[model samples]
Target chain A: MQRLVVLPTSRTGWALTIAFVAVVVAGIWPVIDLVNRAVLFLGLPLLVVWSYVLIFACFAVMLIANRVIEWQEGEDD
Target chain B: MTSPWPLLITLTYVAIAMVIGLRARGGRRMNSLEEWGVAGRSMGPVTLYLLIAAGSVSAYTFMGAPGWAYAKGVAVFYVAVYLAYLALVAWYFGPKVWQFGEQFGHVTQASAIADRYQSPALGALAALVMSIGSIAYAVLQTVGSAYILFVMSGGMIPVWLGVPLVLGCIAIYLFVSGQRAIGRTNAFQGVLMLIVAWAVGMWALHNATGGLRFGPLFERLLAEHGEFLTLPGAGGDMTFSFWTTSIIVSMFSFMPPVWTQWMSASSARTIRRSATWLPTYYVVILPMVVVGFIGIFSLPDLARADTVVLEYAMQHLPVVLVGLLGAGTLAASMSSSEPFIHSVALSWSRDVLQPLLGLSDALTGRLARWMIVPLMALVIAPLAIAEPGSLVMILLVGLGFATQVLPAFIGMFFWPRASRLGVMAGIVAGFLVTVAFTTLWPHPLGVHAGFWGLMLNLPVFVAVSLVTAPADSEVVERFFRIAAPRGLTRLGSGGKTVAADTAAHGG
Candidate 1:
């Protein structure tokens, strides 16, 4: 039986794959260092706010990139 | 001091939903299974957004999130963490799924994967797994709705009656109107539930704490019961690892059924636009979280943390408002249950039945409606017999099905050489690993088993895909021709054939 596959073949795809993996790893790494006390003055609110902004920005960039790629493809057509 | 007005108002809401469903049945132009199951695959952004929000933010969010916050303190904020991640997933995958759905005329996630991988067996397996998980999910909603009714009626309504009643409504609506009814009712329920949630949240917080300020309450909790506020507190409460893992799990869990919804969107642009703004629902949930926080300070000693929101509303809010809150909770459960019922039916009829029986889309859509009765009975009967578990735990278990979809769905977009062999291997491996981790292990390094399973699944997906020979180039090219960036700019040359088939088949 012939196998069927679906996905894009492009640098953008590879980049996204790498970035997603990196974020998953980095986001969870802090859970391992249980006893290490880092004295930071930043409050939970600031951290929460910062994380939201960061995540939103990441997705915004991804959406924009996809849009640009589509636009470029339209131009090529 | 008793009043029947609250019960009257809630009955009115239920009647309105049923009326909407009946009206929607008149507009049925369902010539195909996709049109029946996914609203003819023609939902606009607003409708799609409402459908998604209504389908996702279930009774769990109405009661469970706040209840969790009340019990676990700040750690409950992880719910928001997952909601944000869910939006990201939707934003990334939504348009692509829509494009593929449009091309293949796909109705279910399994059909999409099966088509992409050229494996009917894989599709059957996916449909089976999804059905099992979705039925479990439906039961959870049944339990939630029953619990709300039981509580609201002050135990006048028995669990058996309530469970069947709620499931009956879902079955009737799903049978009568299909996805059109689901979308319309979801839109109405979504608005009512949101308003009720916001009103109850704001009113409860204002009345309990005398203002929106939670600073004093937080400080008090810290002083007296600091353990509840922090992870793995002195009392062996939730740990930081647990909190982090739960966040990750919740974020990723939005993939499975939601992907089906994305595929059902009317257009790629609708999917894109919906993804962009859907996170606002998460933003609206802040008030619910605040209500939970307020509950901690006001009713710190309350038992059964899942009842925190309801208990607070009962104790503090006026009678009419309490009924509204009860209706809102019911709406949350019904909104999710209705769409899920339709999706489950679609999965069975499209992925399992059509392939097995060689039935046309019209036959399948009719079969799907017939399937809803047995499905609802299956879910509600068990819920009535068995006691409900922790809402979060139940939610997580239901969400485990979603994790299984990650490798195949994500690989479709990002990994070009992802073969059917690899996708199948990944799915089987993911399922086994998730089940083993969940059942056999107490805790894998103090993290949820789903996280461990996901960790295992990703590597299996990559390793198998890389080691296996690539799929046929023609198939790959066709997929890209329909789904890639360039594909988005121009309609497929094969569009004529699909349109012809749709017209012939009554899509």
Candidate 2:
């Protein structure tokens, strides 16, 4: 029952899920509706900057996930 | 090629990369298919990162992306966004692939996918679909590289000669050393493109705006052309739904080159480490697209949007820097093209021809090696010469079909309920729907045909699986067991394992 927690077991899984949602949100409805405008930020368009931020966010997440992921050998009979 | 300076840089870049390729030509004799196809699975983290990074960026980034920025404005940011997600995809799936690759001798994506489902026929189908998609990409590379050579040479190098010249060189090196050559050459090209991409972008930005700072530049552009900085861009060419879905579809688009590079890594950790850094690789797209934004203000009347980078660099930078930029574009294009050609040839020989015709291992390897020349000349050369569409458009069309495989790939790792028959039906239906949507009647409410296809694909996949018999329990067990994430452990298949594999192919 304890193992049934909704949280991802590994950092990699969390990054994978979050990055997936981030991409769709940045690229799709509901979320995209907010960012898809004519404003400028940080010397770039607000929308373009949004994409850059997402890329960096994914990068940051994977950096954390990579630290946690490890390889183990299968059992020997 | 009147501009000997750029032509010289291009030539020098070519010579250095050729030397790297020749040096990577594997030892003594051309040996096992593993050595040829996956570099004997001996790539370290740095080598794999460079190879994957180079494989991702192409003439499209140097030329087409800026053109999209120049012509369509903010729409080009789709390129950068999708790539970041691609890195995350690689990190999550790559280790599992590396695990499976070790336990089984799977050298191609189709082989691995087919093995998971315990279906050779499914593998063959995947091989066939991916071959078409990969060849379409190879064609884009051929056309894109030829365009660079032609333009840089000041019309001295014609498209006819340029296509074969670039293709011939790549074919020979790939033939000689296979994936080893690609890894070595990619490392050289990848570093050059990243540095040159930023330099050219900064120069263009500064030249156009009087400074490299983007806030002022965007502010100015907002004053002059407010619409260019927002969705649907300048002329409202790409709408909100189209742009968003394009990013989503392109992000998930299946590429065998990525998997090929992943399988070659020494361990799953090597892949995870490499994937961690891959998002930074999108740095190339940022500057290249900035160059595009610069072109909008500086050289707004260019005949072809695809020539935005070339035209902008010529106007702003010195001859030497322009030449260097030209060299980088060509090097980037050539570096990116070879892997697709190699992957296509691999899937054809290992996954399709071997299984379809029942060819022996030795025979398939020999046949695959010989197949590259005709495959390029007869199939890809015509399209390269035709210059059928913009690099991004042709690339997207290919991606539409490639994205059809996403359900299958996702089901491989996550969904135990996914049956081979169910997945296969979904793929076929999705492929057909995508083709019809892209060709027969496009702009289905401005949602990319691929996204719409996915809409139809998911239900069929789930519905059919609900009714179909599950895969054999033993096969299913092996699939999940091998793919399950685990802590650091000993390598399984090497009999005398010592931390898995890596030292490159001889050199």
Candidate 3:
């Protein structure tokens, strides 16, 4: 019988997943707690900037990580 | 007394599209299926970026976005938020698919899946599902274009005239130049639509509140229709549940026939690089939100919420701008429809016909090209007769298909042990659960049924894969080596030599 083994998560992966979850929670907490206030003072502009920045950062990180992994792998090969 | 200028401009655009398609025949020798289907996989970064962006933003962006905003206030921002994540997901998943496509000479997503899994049946099933979903999506685009024409002509142009005319143009272009036609037309439409959207938005904002700033407009909207601007209060339609479901639906926006454009990228890096800038295209939709905001304050008593953008443009903007807006909306509809027509054709020809009949690539490609006209007729004819539901509902149904495919995609990427059985079970179970929840009740708890289905699908997929023995080790390793290759440039090169060497003597 083949042994069932769980793969270890990489540090970068763990950190990224945690950071993404944290940002989402932080963003949503205020929306839940202060609905109207959030819309007026924080939500609109925050959402607009968040839409652009977060998406850009996410793609940037993925691209960078892929490139780094590929570079390292190439060196090893 | 309708002006002929708008019709003239639109006709000119169509004429130009046809000219590009017909003119493309002279430049290149079409020897192989690749040239016919994927433009020899020769797209550069800029064309790739524009094509991918235009493929994703459709009539949904032009009319549906502002319509949703007019109907559902701040909740519509979820669409933008979803688009952001969709690009990110594409950034991650797209490269691997592109790598596989390059290595195996894959022409469609199903081709890659079938090749990796060694299952023709799975590939055929995927093709069937995507084809049905794409036709539904194409029909929606056709209907949207017709609706726009109906609005622009002030009912002079029949709905029947709108669908056939627009679809006829799309069919002719797609049949003539294939991906080349789509790429050039998309780039043209993408730029013009962005300019026109910005112009209409600025003009609407200026006319409504005397400037582009949102301060005055926001205050006015709050004073006039406070509830519309915020989440629904008790007993209102925009409950916590609806908001959560909307978010979930938004997440699956990236996984459709439209995303087939990502699969056809010239290289993995091209796909990755394009993902970075595609979200910036979402800025084009910000104008729609502005238009919706104007609608709320300016025309509070309008009966149908979906007409807010068009109605506002008609009343407030100059006639020339209105004409431009009409052209822009038509561009949005056609931009989406043509690619979808091409994708559905590819799905049928490459995925279903070739596998089932063992036809040559050339024969299949010819069949695919011929298939577009009939498929266009099939979609447009029905949509003209019976107007489909709201664009949001149509979009959600499309997302449901994506959700069904998500488990399979996730398994293929991250979980090497995930068997075909596991994948199939997860898809079937997830799809049924989503349908049951979405239809039987207002999605269990607050979340969208699709999200819950996805949430359930992952675990079932994992458990089933675990229960089943892992797939052949060589196959799994080959997928990993291709997906996360040791040498990036070597990723798509066939691993036949490696597999053979390993087979002769164990690695």
Candidate 4:
């Protein structure tokens, strides 16, 4: 029987969790203020681009996390 | 007669939506609460995706978002930020929620929480509090639909007439079909809204800059309105603190309708996959926000910024496109409202009335189905007609109230030491603080009232739990065993094994 783990077991899962939190925080205040400028990056404002970038960053982290979850499920099965 | 085309097209769309919703039962019997409340928990990923995405987008995307963007500028992007975070939250929590629901016959969020803490009264309390938020949102969407029809029909369909006409149709379908109706109609409405958003966006871009390109228009906006591109926004009222804190509050708020959507999914994998792809659908918001930015140039100085999109469409777009935009707005409003309305009925009957009155499951389901009419007609529709002040403010305040339950959720999902008394106290304290901050102080120290509420709630919860006796160990263990069947491992410490000990086993 698989033992109940209170947190993610995989190193990648831990790293991804931290990274995802960082990415979300980066899209908001204080950290976001650094990039919240009037300048354009690839046709959009820097702040707007940063928000989109963070969104994709979150997607990437979650996708990897999904893989980890599936791997764990495989072990359980 | 003001060309009658826009009104005709919008009415036709409403009729089509009603047909879709009524037919969604697929000739199956919806005799039980499970079938009506959550589609028997059989929703596939595609429909779940649209239901969640469409429900979250709401009339706010069409009305409130552009209103904020037009009036405040870059500050409006906060909507996009929180929306992405909501997807991430669902991905993390969805599987656990689904597991518990499958194992323990949980059809509502309150039911799950109630089961975990072993308190039906707590469940009833949560149901009452969450209903407040759900009602506020439902009314907002109702008002939005009425506004769209009013504008589209050149005031021929007044707010009083329009509110009943459209909502009445949605009410009838919901009364008959339930979440199956919500699933089908959301998918249809989701597609229609996306098309309308893109069409309206591209047309606006072309008209504003003389080409179908955002680059030139954005450059022009930068050159002319530089302040709009940065923090504090055009209005400077949406401060950095306010913006960031609002996102934090929104990301955690346990909105009842969203929980129902999660429970409706076919599997944990379906929920995860749906959450994974839901972010991409938020691209719909971009075009709508752009339409607002376009408004700054095309039709500046509009009273009530929510009307920017509709006003712009009427003034600039072709008649057919205007009608299409009207249909799309109605879709956005109805798609969101249906689920919240459904959730209110389900939560009330199952979580509150059932436990209090000791009603049977079949009877509860029947009551929930019938409850939709009186609630919508008597409560929700009348509020919408009253036209409550500031859609975004109403939404934010509702979220503030809803997020008070986060402490209870933390206990259920993570901390076995957390007791029922602790959670109840925390929610009460949090609610009081939220009310005070929102009304009297108003974002004290520039932080959101919801966050401020959490500030008081967390400590009270931790302190109370530490000082008091913990919950029944058997109940806690049962929840953990199902929710984390493979055992949840610890995060950080390089995936090191810190013994879960009694905590894992629910001591």
Candidate 5:
């Protein structure tokens, strides 16, 4: 139990972890430069558009994580 | 000459905030450290949301962020990006921290770290570092609050008077209502700032572009000064490495005021819910950044970049809107200041003085209240009054120092092999490296000095832990049970495994 607690024991946990890591990497690795040319996407700069997209991604990931936790807690009950 | 109407409206706003804060007491006597420091752990998701959101957005959001946007174009978007990432961090870590607090009676981060490492002295060290950072930050906010009033009042209020006026209101409610005051006032402040941010943004867009739209503004900006639209910004100073490293440092560095907010949650679910929704609140930064971009063409050649938003507003907006802007900025300043000042006092009493003297909880709570006055009047107020130019630089270094706690956090939450000695060595070495790079060399090779410090810190931590003995397995397991509790039923069940608990219950 102790070991599994530290590492993700379930597939959902692993998927969330990978998604979160991808988000962090895309955020800080100059990946935005690929889309950072002097152009607008969705009425804003591409870089700015990418930032809000990441924000939306973050919200989606956390929402899923929270729902999983709720399900796990209910199962325990 | 500036009209006193703005000042009068701001004062009226202050009076309303005071009423809300005092009324947040809700007829409870805040006697214990748990009650006062963390509002008896009764805050729901909404209140917690407002408290954390408002406290995180400070005078920086009002002034410095826009200042960055005015000076460096896309680089300022890093604020929005990192802040969004911070919500993800809070989502992951906040629940675990709340569980530790609930299980072990840990109101302060230092106490939790101390218990995890079995080192009161390390807790003392954390308390000192966190307090210095908190106080320096509070001083900046106090100075900012005073500056807001001084500017909005056309210098009629003066810094000396404005400092006490803003800090004094916080102190009164903090002394009486404690975290409850912060929770309520922050909610009011959060709503106000959000409204003001959107209102000011739309108004600026309408007046400047002759229409209420951002497309034309972006077109004009890209057409005229295209360099400001991308990375490394207009001056070509904020490189990609610098931008990325800054976001990483700001995202990971644990602000102690935020910890107290986490502990004040009613349940781990509340913490998770609040963190999940927090990124949406960061949309407020979009308009404020727009206001900064508006300044690029509308009011150019500003001597001080930070004053661009205020200067533009005063020059262009009506008296009522200007007054609303002043109230919103003041709310931003005071909302953040209250929690920081309260945490400094709470940590000093509970983590520092209480442990050193072995004082009772009641006495510690009393001492925390007493310390607030001297903390503000003697330490923070004086430093803010001096307003030395170097303090901002020092504040930045203090923030850098905070990221050094990452190793200790890892030890508490994961990596059962992490030793107390290893954590201590890593933090001390990390802090020194951070100071050296930030002060002496300053962001060498375009990477943030704090990131460099962490680079050295992780290896040292691993090396020391490999050599040093690990903590007791049973105690470590107990912590894991409480922190993760994946298969366990409840946090308050004394760390029992589900199998054993079910069998013991005759299942």
Candidate 6:
């Protein structure tokens, strides 16, 4: 997990990019409309709930990427 | 007549911010342009986070988010995803910038590009684009502060007066302390805005619904005003593609202020850690969204959707709380606006003027910076005062143009083959195309203008670069050395398989 810092590296970057594209696709259009058609979860629309989920996923990924940077900085010493 | 309580609270916040600004300077001699412009590159994570978040969030969250929510419904959530992506963009790009700045003494974004591509013209071009965006954004903040003042003062202070008054205060602190004042003040404002945003969001929920939970209330909105809960909301304006593009455009806008903040950090890890904690601040403004939703039912006939947050604050919270929260909201806008104003000043002085005049002296740099602080504020104040109907559109166009610069950074760090000629051509072409898409033809195929511009820009940039000369090998190596992956491979160039890496960094 920590090794993934400096995510601009082609391999890790590709994976993150794919994940983000997937997230973007899932959040927009046809799919979001599909979620909108569903029943509310905890009183919020499924689409809104889904956006939070995707955003959280972004946070989780960023956290790992951050750790990677920190871990590598330590290695530089 | 204006209420004394709200005025008092706002004044207290301002007074505290002023003291913080003064203290931030702390006897440090700002001997060079770098020190004044980037806080001498020594900000910790906490100060950096506050500065970045306060600079970015601004009137957009406390006021505009609720305004969008009140007017358009689910369409407003575009703020959420784009902001998250912006953090991601910052996280990915910021550290590399810090490394370059540390190694190269680069203060302005244009300086980095000029150094990297060995083209002073390219750097000047970047400074030009960023100045336009920063000035427009500062105007938006001015308008936002005017509205907040109008609400807090019970309409005693008008927009024309409000614009100069707020900008005047910002100009003073900024001229005196530069980035240190801005960073320290942001720490106070950031925490205050967060606490207040949540409080107001929850209060709006309770005041409107007779309860704290918004899930049930929102479901009714879905049941009754279903259009509000879906795309092309309320007015049928927000298309799926538009929503996605707005977020994408925002993520890639690459404002100069963010560049200054990123370069100002003490370490790359500070940037990463600050960026990591950034998303949690999302919850801070969730209530503003809820306030907008409340406006959908409670204040149905209000003329301006942007006034929703203020209306809710006045109607729901007590006078004292309104005073306190209003101070926070106004503080948020003011904090964010200062950076925009400051960036414009920095770019105009350090990037544009110095290059044009060929000044290398530290005293000259500081003088140029000081001159622009008041000059830029005065230039933009009237426009904010005029309160043109096209302010939002102008801001959008500015941001669209800002997006044109993204390819340069991408080319510099990731694509070794990206030539200066190609970038300059792409920027010109992209700006022209964005203008066409935004004004002449709004949202081609329901996609936002900025995205349409990029759709054209990226291909042109790549095609031209492939044919033209590449940047100096040594310059490319220096950028890549810092941004390079573990084995000194340039960004997005590690481990073969060019196609995959190319797609990953394309954003």
TM-score of chain B of each: 0.89, 0.92, 0.90, 0.96, 0.95, 0.94
Q: Taking chain A by itself, what TM-score does each prediction score? A: 0.46, 0.59, 0.47, 0.76, 0.82, 0.62
State the lDDT of candidate 1 residue by residue for B1-507, as single tens digits: 256655666667778888887677676665467667777677788988888888878887877778777776545555555665666677667887777777777778888878877777778777877766676677777788887777776777678888887777777766777888888888888888779888887787679757765455555555676655544533365566776777677666644467677876877778767766665666556567667777776777887777888777778889888888878888888888776777787888888888899998778878887888877776545654485555435445556656766776655564456777787777677777777767677457778777777877788887887788655555555665544443221124322222211211222
**Models sorted by TM-score, best on top:** 4, 5, 6, 2, 3, 1
lDDT of 4 by residue, B1-507 (tens): 287888888989999999999999888778688899989999999999999989988888998899988988878888888999999999988888888888899999999889988899999898888888888889888888998888888988899998998789998889778999999999999999999999998898888888876788779889999988988889888888998898999999978888889999999999999888888888898888888999998888798898899888888888888899899999999999999999999999999999889999999989999889889888998888888676556666677878889978887766667778898999889989998888788898889999999999999988887777766767777776655444545444444343334444532
lDDT of 6 by residue, B77-171 (tens): 87887777778888878998988888898888888988888988889888887777688788888888877787777788878778777877777
> Which residue ranges in model 1 land beyond 4 Å of their true spot?
A1-77, B226-240, B254-256, B388-398, B466-470, B486-507
**Each model's total of backbone clashes:** 3, 11, 1, 9, 0, 3
In candidate 6 the C-alpha lDDT for residue B365 amounts to 58
Q: After superposition, how far is residue B269 of candidate 6 from its true place, in Å?
A: 0.9
What candidate 5 gets wrong by more than 4 Å, as runs, is: A1-5, B486-507
Better of 1 and 3 by TM-score: 3
Q: Per-prediction DockQ scores?
A: 0.16, 0.36, 0.23, 0.45, 0.44, 0.30
For model 4, the DockQ equals: 0.45
Give the alpha carbon lDDT tens digit for every residue of B322-404 in model 2: 88898789878888888888888888888888988999888877777778888898888877887776644555556787888
Task: List the pairs of residues colliding in candidate 5.
Answer: none
Position A12, candidate 3: lDDT: 58
DockQ of 6: 0.30
Q: How would you class the docking of model 1?
A: incorrect
lDDT of 1 at B235: 36
Model 4, residue B179: displacement in angstroms? 0.4
Q: What's the residue-level lDDT of B76 in candidate 4? A: 87
Native contacts matched by each model: 0.05, 0.55, 0.09, 0.50, 0.41, 0.31
Report the CA-based lDDT of candidate 5 relative to the real structure.
Answer: 0.85
* TM-score of predicted chain B, candidate 1: 0.89
